[model samples]
Structures are given as C-alpha cells and as structure tokens.
Target: MTDNWSEVDLVLKTMVSTCLANEKYFGDLDSVVGDGDFGYSLARGFEKLQAQYDELDRTDIGTFLKKVGMLVTSRIGGTSGPIWGTGFLRAGMTAGATTELDGATVVKMLRSAVEGIQARGQAELGDKTLLDALVPMTDAIEEALAAGATSTEVVGRAAVAARSAADATAQLVAKRGRAAYTGERSRGSVDAGATAVAVIIEQIAEVWKTRESR
Candidate 1:
C-alpha cells in the first residue's frame, strides 16, 4: 500500500519528468493524425507543476492532487487541458483528504479519474483516446491487487496492460479528438494520448521497481 504523501509526491514527480522527457516523442506521435500539440500541451502543463512543486499544498494527498489539477487546467492550452485536468480533479475528489491509501482506495481513485475523463471528453472505451489504455491499466491494477501482488508488481502489470491497449489502438478508428477528422487515415497510427498513458505507466513501474530494489 502507498500509505504516505511522500510516495504520492514521488509518483507525481516521476510523471512530470516523464512528460518533459518525451515532449518531442509525444508531439511526433500526435503529428501523425492529430494537431501535433498533444505532447507540447502536456509538457507545458507539467512544466508548471514542476516549477511550482515546492509551493504546492501538501495538507493531504487529495488537496495536493486538487491543486495540481487546477494548475494543469489553467496553465495548459487546447482540448488536452480540460480532459486531463478533469481526471486529476476527480481522482483528488475521490481521495477526499485521505493521508493513507490502500490498494482498494487507489483503484477507486483511478476509476473516478477514468469516469471524469469520460464525462469531460464524452469518450468511452474503444474511442481510441487515452481511455483505451487507462481503463485497461486500471483493471490490471485491480486484478493484481486482488491476487495479492505487491505495489511494484501491480504497477508492472498495469504498465504491460496499458502498453498492450495503447498499441491495439493502431487497429482502431479514431472516434474522438482531432484524429477523428482524419477518418480512415487515422487507422494505421496509434493514438498519441493512449501512447502517453502507456509511457507514463511504464515509467512509474520502472521507478517503483528501482525503489523496491533499494
């Protein structure tokens, strides 16, 4: 179980670093079918979070996440801002001032985040959006926890599931975002948002494995 704010902080920091490092890679993926700004937009938002990391509220996990969500919403540009921001906001709301998080709580928070993304973007499974990866990732986490896996093991499973799901989006038709405008042309390329989710989860899992080794 991730039972402290410091661990949560570490995960968020890793996410920020991952986004910054992959800015160009993500942008290139987006250029395939999207407006080519998904990476730029996400990196810009996370840069703000990185810049003000020390100043963020740490009263609790929920408060911290809510602040991060608000920053992402206001600082990021384009459609990516609201959809991603809503996920953080809803996850924080579900956490509700908690200081400790068990596996079940984490899964619940993830579910809430996924729902928020769906509601904000009017997206669903098979939409070829980030949801394609995120939903499967969450399910893998839940399953890993149910099977009595360690936190690192659960994250590893999630990373695999997210990557597989993201890759599968290459076979799907874009049904959301600017990619949808491409019609059949979008079928061969993977969704940038989904790929980003997979990359992020993979980074998290890698970080967790290193931490466990230490």
Candidate 2:
C-alpha cells in the first residue's frame, strides 16, 4: 500500500545520504581488489543528485527518477556511473507516468532495474557484481509483499537478504569489472558494489521503519 512520490523521494534521499556517509568504507572495500575508486565514484555521483534534488522535476515519479539517473550517469566516474545509472533509468522507465506506486509496482520496478543492470554490465547472478546482492534483495521484496508484509517488513527482509548475498560474494571470484582483473586474488574480498547495495537497503529499511512508526 506504499503510494505517493513523496515516499519514493524519501527513499532516494536516504540512499543518497547513505552512499555519501559510507564513501570511505566502500572505497576501502574496493581497494582490496579494485581500483579503490568505487566509493569515491559513487559518492561523487550521488553528491550531484543531492545537490540538484530540490530542482528535479516532480512531474511524476518516473520523471524524477529519470532525471536522477541522467545526472548520476553523467557525473559519476569509472564504470560505476553507467551501471548504477542504468538501474535507476530502467526503474524510471518501468514506472512511466505513475504518481502512486503499489507494492507490486515497486517489485516490477526493481525487477526492471535488475535487468537493466545485467544488460548494461553484462553480468549475471553469480558474477560477484552488484547483481549478487540486488537480485536477492528484489526477490526478497517480492516474497515479502506476497506474504502480506507491511512496508517496513518488506524493506527489512530485503536488507537482510541483500546483506547475506553481499557477504557471500567473498567466496566468489570476480567475473566482471575491475575486480575481475585480480583473478583468484579477488575471492577473499566482498564486492564493493554489492556491499553498497546491502548498506543502502539496510539504511532504507531503518528509515522506513521510523516512517512507519510516525
């Protein structure tokens, strides 16, 4: 029953803030096997979003998200830009002109975002990429809603699933992105992008829980 663009805006705002706050942590995770710029790049992109947030078109959820996607894509550095940007863009496309979003629509939007990321990054579920966490997170959200969970419960379950999946990436060898270049050396460390997803979801869950109480 989660509806309205303001709620969506709040979620996005939380995501942006979470990314900014975890910039150093994410960069450290990436440095284990990547170029160590994952956090920096993501933060820089979200910074632009934060800066222009108030100015974004609120014509509809779709329009607002599309603008955010475009801004992130153009501003973020390295490969993170296109990958993260595509996720947002595809979600926006799926949302279309909708002003209110139900649970089912939210799941659909997440599925579309995951597909877009897969296509854009040429990645799969076990690729040790963000998909590892994102796919499970989306699935958890769908399952939670199907089971009649409330908004807070749905996001809380998603956060747990994402965290578990992201942690499991430590056992996987990178198959894509800069981390892949490290071969077996990447097996010991978690994927930065996947970890970021988990952290963001956890923050969103907390925020949603607080919102629900009020």
Candidate 3:
C-alpha cells in the first residue's frame, strides 16, 4: 500500500514522538552551534500537529497539510520550522488524497521540500543545511525506485543516505543558519537543522514502511 493521508499523520506523529524521546540528544548537540531549541521546536510542532488534526477533519491531504504547514510556521518560532513548513505545504500541493506516495511522489516531494527550504532559508546542498541530508535522501529514493524496490526498501535506502549526508555536513562550512557565523570552525560540526531533518525524514519513512507492510 502506498502511503496515504492516514500514513502521513501516523508518520508525523511518530517522528514527533521520536524527536521528543530524543530531545536531549538533539538539544545537547545543537547547543554547540545553535540555540538548543531544536527539541523544543520539534516537540511544539508535534503538539501543534495534534491540534491541527483536532481542528480540521478534512480527509483531503492537501487541505490537511496546508493547515499543518501554517500551524508549524505560526506555533514554532525558528528558521527550521518555516523551512519545513513550506516543504509540507508543497507536499500537500503536489500530493493529494488520490496519491499513493509512490517513488515518483516521494522524489517530487523531497525536491519540493529542499527547494522550499532553500527558498525560505537561502541555503543549498553542501551548505551545511537540511538540504544536505534531503538532497541525498531524495537521490537515494529515486535510485531505489529505479531499481524497482518497494517503498519500504526505498525508505531504508533513503534513511541510510540521510544519515551519511547528515554526517557529511560536519565537514562542510556553514553557509546558512547560526552555524554560518562560525565559518571554517563550522567544519566538523554537524548542522543542527540538518540533523533534525534527517531524524524526522528517516522516522517518517520508517513509519511509511510499516504502513506498507501492514
């Protein structure tokens, strides 16, 4: 089964829950280069997600996601939230209720997501930004799909790629976010936003896999 709106909700819930569960891990790491609010922002976003769900009962994924995006932007005060908020909004626009979140959809959504972040944050791949992980995961998912892998397999591959890309950012100069202030010192330091996004996407993909297998 392709990932549906219900699956999207489940994935977001799981990702939010995982982020909350590992809040200290993200907070501790981000303290090195960020405001250390990644955990808080993510937790708030997840809580806001539940609020969005409660406020809106539309089965239309697009409507649901647009609302989600707006809520994230409003409730979460951070560059990451706006960046991710736009991504989710684009996803809603590109993907509707009839969509199954197939390989092509995932590729489009990922591309849109990165573009949305870049557009909002003025960041790019290799910029020690979320784009780093997002770019690679998108490519990996496409590759897995080209090889005829199932959604679960594609997600597994994407997750591996996301992890590698997140690690790679540590070696790059920060060109966006607070890390940009550190210049060369930013090198060898993983980006807080990238790491957070990596965790969210991988967790979401895993949830998607579980839905597929069920």
Candidate 4:
C-alpha cells in the first residue's frame, strides 16, 4: 500500500467529514460532563480546515500537517484546539519533509503527537481526557508493529483499542478540564474528547484498509 501524501489528504478529509457527521452526538456526550460545545468547535474548525485544504503544500506532508495544526488552532475552540494543534505540529516536525510514511514512520509520528499532547495538556493516563484513548491506542499500535504486524493490522488494532479506551473513560473519575468540576458526577458519561480521538483513529484505519485492498 502506497501511503503517500495524496492518501494522507484523503484520510484527513475523511476525518473531517466523519467529525461533521457526528457533531450532534459529540455535543450530546459533552453535555453530560462538559460545556457541551465540543461538537460545534470541532465541526466549525474542520469546516474551515476543509476550505483551506487545497492550499496546503502537497509536495511535503510535513508542511501539510503543520498547516493543519495552524488552521485547527486558529479555528477550533475550547481545549481541543491547542491540544490537537500541538499534536499535529509536533507530528509535522517529526515528519520533516517526508512525503510518505511507512509503518515505522507512522509509529514515530503518532508517538510524537502523543508526546505533544502530553506536554501541552499536562494530562496523563486515566485523566478522563483524550489521553485516555490516545496513549492506549498508540501503545497498541507500537506493540502490533513490534510483532511484525502489517500496517493495516497495526492501525486496526490501534483503532479497536482506542474505541475500547474511549468507552472505558465512562468508568473513570474526572481529573481534568471541565469534567473535573463535576467530580463524581462525571462518572458514567463518555468523554467527548476521547470519543473524538477514537473516531479519527478509526477513520485512519478504515482509510488504510481500503487503500491496502486496492
């Protein structure tokens, strides 16, 4: 499977579309434990991002990803903006001028993204934040890759683990963000941010699976 810049673009577009489609659902989930604007922020940000998609430099994935970070940071709201923006920016830096990413490269990029989020958010595992989903998913991908799994398998495994981790957030006590204000009340509700993380990873896995089949 040739996971080139064009394929990455398609994957990003898919992520935007998917986030738009589930906007209301995300809002509803956030309403349970947060300020309830997570969906609107994500939808609006991605909409603007889609408008500027063609402006990204296609020759370098690093430039494209950095552009993505800037756009999301400028347009998105709440904590999602900075967290996601930092992640993409760090990933872009790690990618440098590369136009294509093999499995190892993908692992490195994702690890950088995770590290960026950690540095920016100051959150860790069991924080009832996106980290709850991202960290586990990244670990799953790394383990799969270490076991000689195919790219498709690695992404698929990560997605599945991310979904489960997102779901597990409902069982965790709030420790960060607005959810922390709820204290015990935050329990039993899914985290919108974690769900968003799962959704994007799932979309990436889906894109890769389709690409590999072709």
TM-score of each: 0.98, 0.98, 0.89, 0.94
* Model 4 weakest 10-residue run by lDDT: 1-10
Off by more than 4 A, model 2 = none
**Candidate 1 local Cα displacement, residue 3, angstroms:** 0.6
| Winner by TM-score between candidate 4 and candidate 1 | 1
Model 4 clash pairs are: none
Better of 3 and 4 by lDDT: 4
| Reference-based TM-score, model 2 | 0.98
Local distance difference test, per candidate? 0.93, 0.92, 0.76, 0.87
lDDT of 4 by residue, 58-95 (tens): 66888889989999999989888999888889889898
TM-score of 1: 0.98
- Cα lDDT tens digits, model 3, 1-214, are 2555566667667776877777777777677877778767767776777656667646676677777788887777677678878988887777666536666876787677777878888877788877888888889989999999876787788888888889888888988777778788888788876787678777877777777778
Backbone N/Cα/C clashes per model: 0, 0, 0, 0
Per-residue lDDT of 1-214 in model 1, one digit per residue for the tens? 6888767977899999999999999999999998999899999999999999889898888888899999999878898999989989998999988899999999999999999999999999998999999999999999999999988899999999999999999999999998999999999999999999999999999998988899
Candidate 1 has an lDDT of 0.93
TM-score of candidate 3 against the unseen true structure: 0.89
Between candidates 3 and 4, the TM-score winner: 4
Best by lDDT: 1
